[model samples]
Target chain A: MIAHKESGERIDPTGIKIGMWLFLYSEIILFGGLFVLYAAYFHRYSESFAAGGEELDRLIGAANTVVLLISSFTVAASITALRLHQRRRCICLLLFSLLCGVIFLVNKYFEWGAKFARDLYPGSETLVGGEPGLNIFFGLYYIITGLHGIHVLIGMVLLTVSLVWVVSGRATAERYSMLDNSGLYWHLVDLIWIFVFPLFYLVL
Target chain B: MSNQSLEQQQQEHLLGYRQLAVVLCLLLLLTVVTVAVSYVDLGFFNVPVALAIACGKVSLVLLFFMHLKYEGAIINISFLSTVLFLVIMIGFTFWDVAFR
Candidate 1:
């Protein structure tokens, strides 16, 4: 939101932010509906879910969690740097955050590759041959993580656009709603992963 | 007006680098704690404990990272209402499953 004193133009920051957050609310509900599905299935197939979670590599999951957390940190910090007119620092932090997102996707690629190698995909014969609940567990796994991966990709694209905007002077300190909103989207991604990690990888 | 001083005047919630770093440390610490806690088998309590920590992390991210802490009442209420509805939906479904 910018207040152009000379032209008497004003943008309400709260209105701008709340508009973005309204969209984020919908995103949360979309994922929340999925979580409810996971809950019901988990309620019925507790053992199968536990077993499926055990098959996952917690180390990789933890590492991704850290990557996302750090990425979020950088994104949030970049906004601060922008506000403070530390343009170089802001750009550097955004580059680092983008790298973190790339690392996350790379890690996910290897993780899913391992799963496919084990024939544990959605309609794999192994799950079809094994306990029915195991199929449900793995099915939910693919759906949730796959959807989240797409969100990560979209977030990276948004981040890239925001980076360019910053570089080109479109998102200055006074007028940075684009960067701020993009950061909000990125944080929502991290927020979802916070729940996903424990639910899918740390099932006890 | 200079952008920097004007921004400082208008945006009270412009988080500093130090504050952002501290929030990151807290989030990382929470992540480690949740993972470490998952190692101990706390039958029946494990999910709850893990979820509790996840909630903590979410709170920090929402408040510090997402700027929800300094936002307006409309946003705060809207978020709370959304979460309430989500809880109701999930709760009702589980309640049905439990009785079945």
Candidate 2:
């Protein structure tokens, strides 16, 4: 319950952390709904879904998994650094995490671009046309991955804001609740990928 | 607490950092195991094996990296409830779809 000298703002770091946890719960449900839909359809077309999943490039998925996992580690390390009052080290780790996030998005861009070029996208315009089940599987695939990508984008922005907070001295060892919360968000992004990796790559 | 108490905080911070690194190494090991296991033709057990490994990795991250293990029980309860509700929702959906 420390008070800021200049602004007299009572910094309740625990409250902010809890708020972020609650928000994370909501996000879980949001994505949980999409997962339910995917599972439902997947049950109906298990073979088609497996076939569609096999069509995906495992190397790219593996690389992206490695990238996101590294980013998660960097962000976690940044939180530890911030807690230690090592502001410079914290900022460096945050920057590294952010760079990893960018690499993930770049990989995703190329992956999606290749899929688009091959017309593997959902809807009637799919390249592998005439197969109803495959089309449905691809439809769910796009929706789920698209939503996960949006979450990654949001996580990147949150990390950027945290980076600014560090540079501006708004965040410090005693006042870095924002960095902790952003770390949680970044971990969620990674968690989603954990599920995605198996569903789209290994399950085939 | 005085701002000058930064030194004490630094020690605790190092402890946290070391714990995080240990957990990260474990995670990497688990990931490697998961990939290796997937290559084997375990048939029906494949999904379960992958998911079991994933759950272990997630538990490590949640407990150590996210500090949920040291946090108050209330936070754990809150997270658990959310997971329970999610399970119920998914179960209901499955029952409805499968039965129909």
Candidate 3:
């Protein structure tokens, strides 16, 4: 293991953070574009969209929201713990956060499974033969949630790397941007879910 | 990298367990409130109310969990601009649709 001092290189925290934020900006716009589509489609088919929303399981949606929110909190706390030089606590919190991500994905799997069983997916007979607005609704549902699920998987990978680095002493109290930035990415995932849950499940 | 920088690092705010827990509780509470409000059938206000609550929840996540409160100006402006762009895109689409 190359010691941080032996490397003779310094991490610019501010620069690293700005880069991450810039990347997050793009993610926002990416999701934002989809939301714009949702807005336009909703304006055209408000009644059908609302009716479609009524059939979704609100209980599962709310449960996933709670899970992500809790994960975000744990990620934030883990960073704080690292800064405080509490390594064990940091690892525990990060593991918990990863577990939260797993739970969220499992819930999503079942949720999508339920929809598939109902023949509600895009281009399926039910959606294809349904009202046009319901078509758009389910279409948006699959695309948005599927894309978000990919992000959750990406986040879990980032978290795992962060944990490994932290354990290896690559992420120390004096320098922990790896873990810090990982936490930020995790929060962005959670942040997107915060809006997504309400838009798709609560409001539609 | 310097001693002064290390000094500043030590001084940086690290929220305690209690405080982070409080933020979690607040987020969860907002979730419950939003879910409850959805059942009321508030006519045209339902969507708006739900979106408003969502914005509230996102703000909390940004300010605390994302540490926007402690971030520098560049990041703050970057995030703000992204939000501005999004609002304009969605708003303009709605405006165009409204007149149709």
| Number of the top lDDT candidate | 1
Report residue B90 deviation for candidate 2 (angstroms).
1.2
Chain A TM-score, cand. 1: 0.96
DockQ head-to-head 1 vs 3, winner: 1
Put down candidate 2 lDDT per residue, A94-129, tens digits, no spaces.
999988988998998998888888778865476355
Query: Candidates 1 and 3: which is better by lDDT?
Result: 1
Show model 3 residue runs off by greater than 4 Å.
A1-7, B1-11
Candidate 3 residue-wise lDDT, A1-204, digit = tens: 112354787557777878899999999999999998988898889888887787689999999999999999999999989988999999999999999999999999999998899888889998898799999998998899999999999999999999999889989887887888888999999988988887888864
The per-candidate count of clashes, in order, stands at: 0, 0, 0
TM-score of each: 0.95, 0.90, 0.94
Tell me the deviation in Å of residue A108 in model 2.
0.5
Runs of candidate 2 with Cα error greater than 4 angstroms are: A1-7, B1-15
Expressed as tens digits, the lDDT of each residue in B26-71 for candidate 3 is 9999999999998898988988999999999999899988889877
DockQ in order: 0.65, 0.39, 0.63
lDDT of 1 at A91: 99
Q: What is the DockQ of candidate 3?
A: 0.63
**Residues A1-204 of candidate 1: C-alpha lDDT, one tens digit per residue:** 455645687777667888999999999999999999999989899999999999999999999999999999999999999988999999999999999999999999999999999999988999999998899999999999999999999999999999999999988887788989999999999999999999999997
